[model samples]
Target: MTMFLTIAVIVLIFVVIFQIAKASEYVSVLKGEEVSRKQNNKINGFLMIVFLVLGLIGVWYCNKLYYGKTLLPHGSASVEGERVDSMLWVTLAVTGIVFVLTQIILFWFAYKYQETEKRKVFFFPHSNTLELIWTIIPAVTLTVLVIIGLRNWFLFTGEPPQNAAVVEVTGKQFGWIFRYPGKDGAFGKKYFRNIDPANNVLGLIWEDELSHDDIVTEQTLYLVKGRPVKLIIGSRDVIHDVGLSHFRLKMDAVPGIPTTMWFTPKYTTKEMKEITGNPNFVYEISCDQMCGNGHYSMKGVIEVVEQAEYDLYMAKQKPNYLDVFPDKDPAAAKADTTKTVAAKTADTAAKAAAKL
Candidate 1:
């Protein structure tokens, strides 16, 4: 059987290793323990040097191999994200210098300072100057990095330009719902209790005139290229995150608390496809938070276009109000009114028949 063969092979390998160890012990006794230890130390020291050289080379090789595959080569997709990229590069440069220097000094000392009769270990314990240098330098460097990050964070979360296009992003169980304020330039009042999965996706109060003009869409969001857009974010069921990697922005979508982030588009989706040399390039909205079972499927798309194209796209979208109350949709016309009434009557009659 495979199990019996596997066990027998393991036992044989252990016996062979034990015999080799016993032979080595007998050889050490013949050579003298002190000389054997010295020889082993020399070999280990040489291996340390070899390891240091190979490690440094491996580091260089890895960077050369994978650096091009990262977003750093393509640069940022938003003007604000350019600051993020700058901060990232600065952090990498500073840490990289420290890493290479420390590694070289560490492994070089191990190899060069191997036990020898010519040298004796010094008893010097600690130096205040050395401690201060190590402590102060890293502290100041981290403080500067933190301050830079905070400044960028404030700029991103703050109120955007007056002409900025605003979109309300609501995260649900397995998808994203985007609401754009129509001509009125205001989002209508929304209540969670008014939620109806069939049509009233965002639970906007129909009584509000603002809700009548509020444009709602799913799967894709459209924005004007080179225009600043503010996102008002929230979640319906649990916590979710709106991750816009291209813009280098993300915000949590909490159930009761709303969050906001804004960014200006540097290139249209079409332009990005051309720039990246990919025909199917699209801006993605990824859920950065783990909400529920269907979390992986929660995704959305963004289409950045010119002002005229954006206008045409908006013009074609019907308001959420019309979908919720089809009777009020002007496109349905008066002829459809009777059908609506008939459907309601049929529903009521069907319920009555069921009860009987």
Candidate 2:
């Protein structure tokens, strides 16, 4: 019954469209003969003026209505982000001026030169001077913009500071994993065959001494305010992207390949909330790529705190799995050996009694 209703609605729509077309044809047949040259000129001129006014008003209000809400948040949260924002504003200003000026000229020409019986139309086809002026101006403008863009790109992508905090962001089917280098400030090697879904999701090689000190978490990336952070990003299953919108940082997390992005957080989470006048505001890390069915749920929070707070948070995290098991420490190893010997002796006695 539902499918039949749907088909009926579609057919009815086509019938209505056909009737509208027939009505338009009849209207054209009657009015087309009544349009005079003077009437055409007057109508075209009026429409040109109306369009010019409406277009400018629309452009003005569009920016006023959506600038802060959708174009960009009022300000940037990082030093590089500020630079990026500035470049964007510069580009917008340049293009906006050209757009408004060209639009006004086009409409003015249409209104001024609308078909009129008394006016003689100018027949000159082209001017080398005018052509050269237009061509040179755009070429020069583009060259300047490109130069500025490349300079800023290099500045932002240059080598990170020595004190930059290193974090590894791993992307998988529908979530992100954050790994922080522990006391040694180095990441352990990873092996694909060693990937344990429950314990070692990153396939970190447990035998590597560095793996013992690595801190891994599935949620809440923690950072220190006013410190540079270097992110090493990778993907396990498919391509994903790490987008830190507030910081204006983005990089692809490609499968079987590693990528990196770096930025400094100028505002702590608390400070940003106060700045934005929203108490619940927090920095977010989102997947910008469409990787799978659950891609929309692939998001994480970034908590920026003071340096002391960051240090305290790191100190409380548990060590890697290998450190707590297998008794790697000498004292713990001896105790484990003793326990094993006692258990073996007890098992032997129990077996002999059962045989008797």
Candidate 3:
């Protein structure tokens, strides 16, 4: 019913417009074409100035209204992200100046040069000097912007610092998988065919001892504040993007191809919550690209903490390997051995009492 009403209203609007147009045509015929054209031109020139004023107001109003809601208010969560923020500001400034100047000139010229009986139209055929100025200025400005962007890009994707911690990120149908290299600081080999939904989420080769301690997790990725983190990203099924808007960095997670980027986190989740004045605030990871139907649901969280807190968290995490092969877990084996020894001692003591 709502849709029908909307359609009816739209149809009524068209009919009204048509009638107004026909009435205008009759009036134009009565007033003569030359006089009507001049009047319409005057109206359009006045409307242009009004539009320019309103548009400028709207731009300012929108920025004022939504600026606080945007990530820009709190600044970046990563040190490297500060550069991204800087670049963005520079780009916006350059483009914004150009936009305002162009708009002002365009509308002001239309209003000032409106058709007048006392004045004649100046035929601006071509000015090579003007053309060169416009072309060269934009080209030079764009080239400089591109160079700055490229330099930042290279630094982001380049080799991380020696002390940087590395983590593997894998994207699947509607979720993210994170892996932390155990004490060995290496990741095990993985085969696509070995992917098991139940136990082996990352398809790590058990034969590869290096993989035995690689920690695998799904919902939350952990990092240390003030420490650089290097991410090795990939996809299991289709293309996905790892968007860290808070950190102001993103990288593509392509199937069969691993991409990498690094950044040093400046604040922890606890710190951000305080900074933003939102007690429930958490750093979020969003899939920037449309992967599939569940792409909207594909989200991950990052928990940044101090080194000691991170160490404690890591200590509590049992590797995916141990989960798959519990018998091989030294902790489990030790417990089993202790239980067997206790049972044996109890049985021996009982036997001695029975003999007595």
Task: Estimate TM-scores for all models.
Answer: 0.86, 0.82, 0.96
Whose TM-score is higher: candidate 1's or candidate 2's? 1
Q: Report the C-alpha lDDT of model 1 over 158-211, residue by residue, as the tens digit.
A: 999999999999999889999999898999998999998988888889888988
In model 3, pairs of residues that clash are none
Rank by TM-score (best first) = 3, 1, 2
lDDT of candidate 3 at residue 230, scale 0 to 100: 98
Query: What is the clash count of model 1?
Result: 0
Question: Which candidate has the highest TM-score of all?
Answer: 3
**lDDT for position 18 in model 2:** 100
Question: Which candidate should be chosen as best, given lDDT against the real structure?
Answer: 3
Worst 10 residues of 3 by lDDT: 200-209
lDDT of 1: 0.91
Return model 1's CA RMSD, one decimal. Answer: 8.1
Residues 1-98 of candidate 2: C-alpha lDDT, one tens digit per residue: 99999999999999999998687667657778356445656877989989999989998898798876752764778877887788888999999899
